[model samples]
Target: MDSGAGTAVGEMFDEMPQEKRARIDAGGEDPPESSWAGLHADALGVVLRFLPCLADRARVRAVCRQWRDAARGRGVAPPLPLLVLPRFRFASLTPGGVLSAARRAWMPPGLDAGNACCVGSSDAWVVGAGQAGGECFIVNAFSHEVRRLPHLGTYDCSLRKVALSASPESAPDWIAVAFMIRWSRPELALWRPGMRSWRVCHHALFAGHIDIAFYQGKLYMLWKFTPCLFAFELGDDEHGVTISRMKDCFIEKLLPTTLGSTHELSCNMVEWHGRLLLIIRYYGGYQARHRVKVKVFVMDLSTNPSVLTEIHSFGSDCIFIGSGGCKSFPAGQHGGVEGDLIYFGPDHYNPHDAFVYSMRDGRTGPIFKPLPCVTHASERNLGFPVWLFPKE
Candidate 1:
């Protein structure tokens, strides 16, 4: 990975855990064949850049001090997301035909990714309530840096969904917005990494909010009941986050032409090319095994009332609707995959299932599992799997 590929994961093992380092030291000096560690810096860079496997690259970094230094802050961006599954197991999505990469020790000492309630994600961080302490936190998948959130009180992972305003590496004001249940009523929790507790905000208008996204420093919410769109600052001062019911962007600005009932349909709000796009999934019914169809629309906020324009393509860009948040990527640059497609699920009914949704034909293809029987897991046994996309 180059600097643009991000430094977080590339330098993940720079500060190796004590025990693991001791084990490596216990093995004593490596054999003569281990002289690969002394390879020239330029040569090391070329090798790491061309290495197809993330796990192999990580191993090369762990070889010796000189190699570790070269591997630090450099490498190719993972072609696809590392399939984050229970017990910290990760299956690297290596595009087509190539072998998948494996995950080494991916966490610090205490976080239990197996039981952690992963709510949302932005960039390379996974936001969720850690299983060990029942406290909420944002953990960097590569660096294993844990920024704890405030007390969850009685609420846990299954009841909420959270998002970050911006990545911590690029922005210090890492505001977190969570739409969760509070005392049987829908509530909004806002906090930064160091906050003592979340700023609990309740808006009667947002009771029906179905999904949320950060757009140009503001929080935009989609309400299913009223077919309304709401926006407010996802920011803070010394006093903490500020919210007001009076700041509704549009009381009846229906972003979707015909909003579906909560049970029959679901939508994800994605920020695409500086414009917010809404992806609606028609699952047919509550018992439907497959999605009937999918639709995409660009929310033309440039207009007075903000018209929703149905679009058939995203050019060379594609979107990932994950458990945490919707991600848009210029996929063509990373791999040979075309744009204008969406990767959805690890389906609700079948945990092993996922689909590629093409907007052109409004059809679905099976989501890549990396390998057969790799992603199969009991739905209730652990936290749901998610695609952890890398970013700085």
Candidate 2:
């Protein structure tokens, strides 16, 4: 019996062999395309982002038609990060929002959408869900083109979180979609840029409410019900998703229930001043007559527990004029504009007003710029605003 066991082990060893194991350990050789023209195109995109002005972006595009084509073609390139801002037509009845340019000093071309629920912008591509039919569309806000992606699942999906990532060195690009199943079970779904199918990711800890952010070739998601965070390395073995709890300074104190207690917390993972930050907000509570207050907090994710810091706090008095009267609302979908400036969806506290806050300026303002796409006041309901950050 011992001899048979030895023979079985020997057979297994013989099948493996040293050279095969060596190649496997070395991650194999890269394909020739890794050093191709795509790399140059990608580098040029970075140049366009940091250069002083749009003229520089155009000048670089004019260097060569290939560069121009590459720059233009990169409308959906996943490597470049983009900030997608949803602008509502100030004149429509239902008033579906239009995606606008969020560049640092210059605005990019504008794109439109129908009943967009939530948006995830990466590079120059924007992925969002439509409220009319729960359909998902992959759009290039720069090119003004929209492509329909294959339906991943149909459960009246509430896509609360969306993130885009591209493999370093011009590899494949991927889009990660996350949504809740109403009252039970949230899911993580992913699709390659050109592929039509999506694979549902299975991880025990990912089953609760969570938010997603992509950084350095991995997907970072924060569970809302708990203070736990999971990072999945993309393209690591059939792009197999492996999750590990992130240990940080402020993570221990995240306090799961705090997010839901005051207002619907708007959690965003963003790069600020060469470091990553998770921005969260508590929009305040009501005690008597629809009085609402909002507080903005910032957490530097580079440290342990992600240290939490408060930016500003403000309060407002609200009166309900509707038959239903004074109701409390949570923090709606939020978008970061101009690097540090944060924009929020409409608030019931000031139902007829639009709010914008600039962390750099340390000031909040009521939006009065007559938006061509959105109505000044909507009797139906307050419009939700989505802030798009610059992808430069």
Clashes of each: 5, 20
Per-residue accuracy of model 2 over 161-273 as CA lDDT, tens digit each: 45656411134545455443433556667666555566666656665555566655556675533335555655534544333333323453654454456564434344433
TM-score of each: 0.78, 0.49
Candidate 1: segments with Cα more than 4 A from true spot: 1-68, 73-78, 97-105, 131-133, 155-159, 224-227, 234-238, 245-263, 346-353, 368-383
State the local distance difference test value for candidate 2: 0.41
lDDT of 2 at 199: 62
The most accurate candidate by TM-score is: 1
lDDT of 1 by residue, 1-392 (tens): 12222223323333454455555557754434465766888788777655544555666777775686676555554445555544445555554422253343346666655566666776778776754236676788766788777766764323356878887787886788887765667778788756788787876766634677788877888763344567785545686876643355462445444535543556667888788887777666667747567777777765676677778898877788765577787666554555678877542223444667787777777655344343455433444556677641
Q: Considering only N, C-alpha and C atoms within 3 Å, which residue pairs clash in candidate 1?
A: 1-74, 1-75, 1-76, 120-324, 354-367
